[model samples]
Target: MKNFFKIIIIAAFGVMLYPLFDSFSGNGQLNDLASFYAQKENVEKVNSANLVTAVVVTYRGLDTLGEVTILFLTAAIIAFFLTKQSEVRTLRRNSEIFQTAARLLIPVIIMVGVYIFINGHLSPGGGFQGGAVIASAVILMLLAFPNMPFNSKLFGLIESTSGLVFVGIAFLGVLIGTGFLDNAILPLGTFGELLSAGTIPIIYSFVGLKVGAELSNIISGLQSVQADN
Candidate 1:
């Protein structure tokens, strides 16, 4: 009976979504606006080779800011719940081999994460992916050394500071450019270079740091809850 109901629900959703399926059909040609944006001259305006990054960090920056806000709120809620637990509990110990591997690998993982976000404007990887990688490294530390002191305070500081920096740059954009979150606030240097793309690298760097710190805090909070259990 449960399986019957599940199938019915799935079929209903499929039927409802069927009309939108035609939206995916492409005629193998760019529309007028799409063609304009796809031109090399237009792309060079943002000073980024990666069009997706250009869209996310420049064209739709406010949307990205909203996403970061959601993550920060979620981490705060998780931390609040974890702290409300009545008892302090320690996690079990792992093998020395695992601990040593984690200690050695954590820095390397963090460096990779930093590199990904720093070069986001020039490359494929960006703030969110890099931040997830950093969070994974924190998860590794928690699993390898369960009793290791995770600094929630430090994470909070980093998160807040980065968020502030991001917002400050956005405001600067308003003051200098066409409107809020404008990428033209800073010089769009030589295209395809590491220092190019105006405020893109700077914005993405803050976003990466803020996201990584928030995710690390959430992981630590969950680990604490698991320890208590």
Candidate 2:
């Protein structure tokens, strides 16, 4: 009887959502607007090597900021769930071969991650993607070596500082422009150059730092929970 009601409710909700989904179209004004933005004149401004990244970080910066906030919130929720456990479980100590391999590979992984982040304004990868990669590498280390304890305080500090810095940078943009996130004040450099994307690269780096710290903290918190349980 309970299962029957749940199925009915889900079906009703799906019926309610169908119209909204059907009404959404990839045609008309939205298509025209997108095409306008994709023109060569605009594309050549931010080096145009990574046109999509420019679109995301500069053309739609506010949306990107909101996305970063969502990631941060997700990390917070994961931390909340994991931090409640009292006895954290430790990884067994017998993976010497795996640990050695991870230790050897960590530096290369970090280098690639940093390269991805630095080139984000001029390439396909961005801060968020690079940050996730770095976090995953750290997680690998955590899994390989059980003796090293993660410093939660440091993680929290980095996350908070990076988030504050991001806001501060955005505020600077506001001070120079009409709104809080306006990038009008920053100087747009020459195209195809390393430092040409105005404030987008800086903002992306800050976002990457904040995201990396938050994700690592979440994973560490989960490990603690496992140890506790």
Candidate 3:
């Protein structure tokens, strides 16, 4: 029967994914690269409290650039998918308590998200982590106030402008620093200060803003579609 074949197919696919489950083993090419970046020479020059962040934002900045590009491309693809459909009903709720709670929490969440992005050079959190946190805050607002419409155009503009600004900063680094994406142009500042790492924090802040906006937009769109359905 068709049901039997479907079950078999799903079981096969699940078996295929089983190999992906593995315990952590740290020895690898990436570990070697990390060790190199953590060396005293690079760490002192970058003046970052978190060596991994320094490597990602400075030494391997081009890779970071590519990663950002991929995210932008993904957002574009998602937008394209949404554009094909019309008549989506935006999600809304009718709970006063939820609305009040969201309003109270939004500011606090935004502050924490900004702090995470700003302190990335000295901590475990970074632009992506902070961005997700902010996006969740936006989602909270959506859940609380279903009737309140979001300005999708404004969010899109902010996301696009922030991305372009990040590109411009990297281009400027080429002219002032060693090369394209080189971050030696700005003063590194103190090792553990918020303003340290030259322009890393600034760049991460932009990334966080862009990512948060885009992700919030995606959630908005998806919820709209779900409501329509």
Candidate 4:
């Protein structure tokens, strides 16, 4: 009976997606709307050399915010579940060589993560990717030093402050610019420069910090559960 229901669901999903596949143009040509967005004049409006970044941070800012919120909620839920459990499990320590390597590589990973988010508007990387990189560094630390002290309060503070700043910037756009999450809240500056792309760099910075902290908090919470067991 369960297999029957699963097959039905799969069939339904395939049926729903069929029209989208059918609508694809056979000719290898860009759609009119896509071509317009790709045009140099349209691309220059956001002052971002990366068109994908311009579309994400400027054109579809709210949608990106929704994605961030979803990630934050997932981390929060993981923390909550870990807290509810009373049993603690001990984690095995890594070898000395592994620990030493982690200690050496963590700083470099963090620096790369920061660079990725900071230059999001000018390059291909952005806050989400950078935040994941930062979180991976924290994961490595957790693995190398099982008993390493993690300050939950500090992580929470960082996450909260960064999220507040992101939202505040969005509201500021309402006050001074055309709409919420408007990149025009700050000066566009020279294209391709470090200081370019108006609020995009600032927004991505806060987002990267917030995501990194949230993920770290989740990992720490899970580690605490293991420690208690």
Candidate 2's C-alpha lDDT?
0.76
The list of candidate 4 runs beyond 4 A from truth reads: 1-23, 84-91, 227-229
Count steric clashes of candidate 1.
Answer: 0
Better of 1 and 3 by TM-score: 1
Q: Please estimate how well model 3 matches the true structure, expressed as its whole-model Cα lDDT.
A: 0.82
Q: Mind giving the per-residue lDDT tens digits that candidate 2 earns over 1-229?
A: 9999999999999999999999987655546667776777766544435767777766777788788788878887887776645554554575678878998998888777777887887877888888888898888878787558688789889888888887887788778765665544567677778787677777778777777888888888776666433
Tell me how many clashing residue pairs each candidate has: 0, 8, 1, 4
Stretches of candidate 3 off by over 4 Å are 1-32, 84-93
Whose TM-score is higher: candidate 1's or candidate 4's?
Answer: 1
18-133 in candidate 3: lDDT tens per residue? 77755445655556667778778878778889877887788777888788778778777777776534564555556778678888999999999989988888999888889999
Off by over 4 Å in 1: 18-24, 84-91, 227-229
Q: Can you write out model 4's per-residue Cα lDDT over 111-184, one digit (the tens) per residue? A: 99999999998888998889989999999988888666788889889998998899899889899999888887
Which one wins by TM-score: 2 or 4?
4
Return the candidate ranking by TM-score, descending: 1, 4, 3, 2
Error of 2 at 203 (Å): 1.1
The deviation in Å at residue 227 for candidate 1 is: 4.3
Task: Compare the candidates by TM-score and give the number of the best one.
Answer: 1
lDDT per residue (tens digit) for residues 1-229 in model 1: 9999999999999999998896778668988877776788879788887888988988788899999999988997888777735576755678899989999999999999999999998889999989999999999988887767888999999999999999999998889897888888788999889999899999999899999999999988887776453
lDDT of 4 at 168: 92
Alpha-carbon TM-score of each model against the true structure: 0.91, 0.79, 0.82, 0.85
Lowest summed lDDT across 10 adjacent residues in model 1 is found at 84-93
